[model samples]
Target chain A: MPQTHTFEMGMTCGSCANAARRVLEKMGEGITIDSIDVPTKRIVVTTEKSAEEVKTQLEKTGKAVSGVRITHIESH
Target chain B: LHQGKVSVEGMTCMSCVNHIQDTIGAKEGILNCTVSLQEKTATVIFDGSLWNGESVAEAIDDMGFESKLIS
Candidate 1:
């Protein structure tokens, strides 16, 4: 089952968003980015991976990831 | 030490420039990293034995931006 997680990140522009998207894409699978909103500094992704795992990957973009919120979870 | 110049793409603003500077600057062998958003370029000073222009460009590329060694 996949879980939808929303993360608060330090993204200022589209390039920052793109960086985040790329990092997640490089995760190789089981992760789908729903949206990256710079204004809200939020990134929403649905993935089978754990939040900690996803958070670690996001940190590679060199942006600060303040926290993660589990917005939706599929019923197993 | 060696100086390298790299052309970078996909940077939209100052934050992108700062991100590049901070990220690359913290890497081993990178003595200095200066990014110019207007010029779409980054000039790096690194240990010659550990890093070169091509490697710096590759590092930038790995950060999800399009980059190439200019000199």
Candidate 2:
């Protein structure tokens, strides 16, 4: 199943959005970032990876990462 | 080694990101700073021996914005 998870990344400014995008882009297969709200520092990512793994990769950017919510799931 | 992440609020455009990048980039102990208008978040890498969160937040506040650490 493909699922979208939201994470509140404690980002400071716009460049942080770029960095977060880069981290998502750099992650291994099975996941794709759908969209992100720069103003809110919230991101929605879709992935085949577990929620924990997704959060871990998102936090890898050195941003404060937390589970916001997960939805829009589809089975493969 | 110390790392910090902060949430920047009241930024409505890309210029806001540039403003923050420049401000944090100039801090004494900061080795790197990245800002995201898309997410309103900034991750900072600094020499902890030289600076801390309050000062960093102050720097952001001085820029005419609001900042708060997440962790």
Candidate 3:
């Protein structure tokens, strides 16, 4: 199953967005970045892992993460 | 070899420290990169002929963080 997770992160610029991408990329395979909106301070990611697990990984990037929510879940 | 310091703003945690260090240290001619979250600064050592403070500052800036060469 694939799950989509949305997180509220403090991102101010393109560089911040890129940094977030880089951090997620470092999380290795099985995770894909759906989008990062700096103005909205929202990051959407799709992965096989649980939202809680993904949130833990994202927090390692040193950004202030306000919240994480499971937006969608796919059985396939 | 050249050693310099740059002040960085908007770092929230040690992960930011590691990200900055790894990002800058990954560049060619960069010998070492140390980032201090508490000080909001980064110190780098690099080959002067192949790199400079401007390039390092630019790299940091490109990462969405504000950086200024202090030395």
Candidate 4:
């Protein structure tokens, strides 16, 4: 099953968003960045990993991750 | 040893501060790194012979935080 997770991060500019994207991309395979809304500071990612696990990884980027929500789950 | 300060952007909590401190502190030449969430800055003490402020700023940037050398 693949899950969609939404995280609220503290990103002040485009560079911050780009850095977050790079961090997630470097976290091995099976994780895809769905969208990053800079204004809202929300990032949505699709992956097999759980929301908690994803949150832990996201935190490594040095951005303040305020919240993580699992919005959707699909069986494959 | 040399002491320097860098301004950091986009930090909203202590975790962010801790992350920055840990990331920069882990570097070989870094002796101490203190990140302030309230000030959005980092004070680092390191071996000047082994590293420079630019590399420290780059490390913070690579970790997804914007950093600029203040001193």
Q: Number of the top candidate by lDDT?
A: 1
For residues B1-71, could you state the per-residue lDDT of candidate 4 as single tens digits? 99888888877766566667877898798999999878888899999998788778767866867788988
Per-model lDDT: 0.90, 0.73, 0.79, 0.81
Q: What is the interface RMSD of each candidate, in Å?
A: 1.1, 9.4, 7.1, 5.3
Over A47-75, each residue of candidate 2 has an lDDT whose tens digit, in order, gives 87777877776665545788568797655
Residue A7 C-alpha lDDT in model 2: 89
Better of 2 and 4 by DockQ: 4
What is the C-alpha lDDT profile of model 1 across A31-51, one tens digit per residue? Answer: 999999999999999998999
* Cα distance off (Å), candidate 3, residue B50: 29
Candidate 4: lDDT of A33?
A: 93
Native-contact recovery for every candidate? 0.61, 0.00, 0.10, 0.39
TM-score of chain B of 3: 0.93
- The DockQ figures for the candidates are 0.71, 0.06, 0.12, 0.26
The TM-score-based order of candidates, best leading, equals: 1, 4, 3, 2
Residue A46 in model 2: shift from native, Å? 0.7
After superposing candidate 1, which stretches have Cα over 4 Å from the reference?
Answer: none
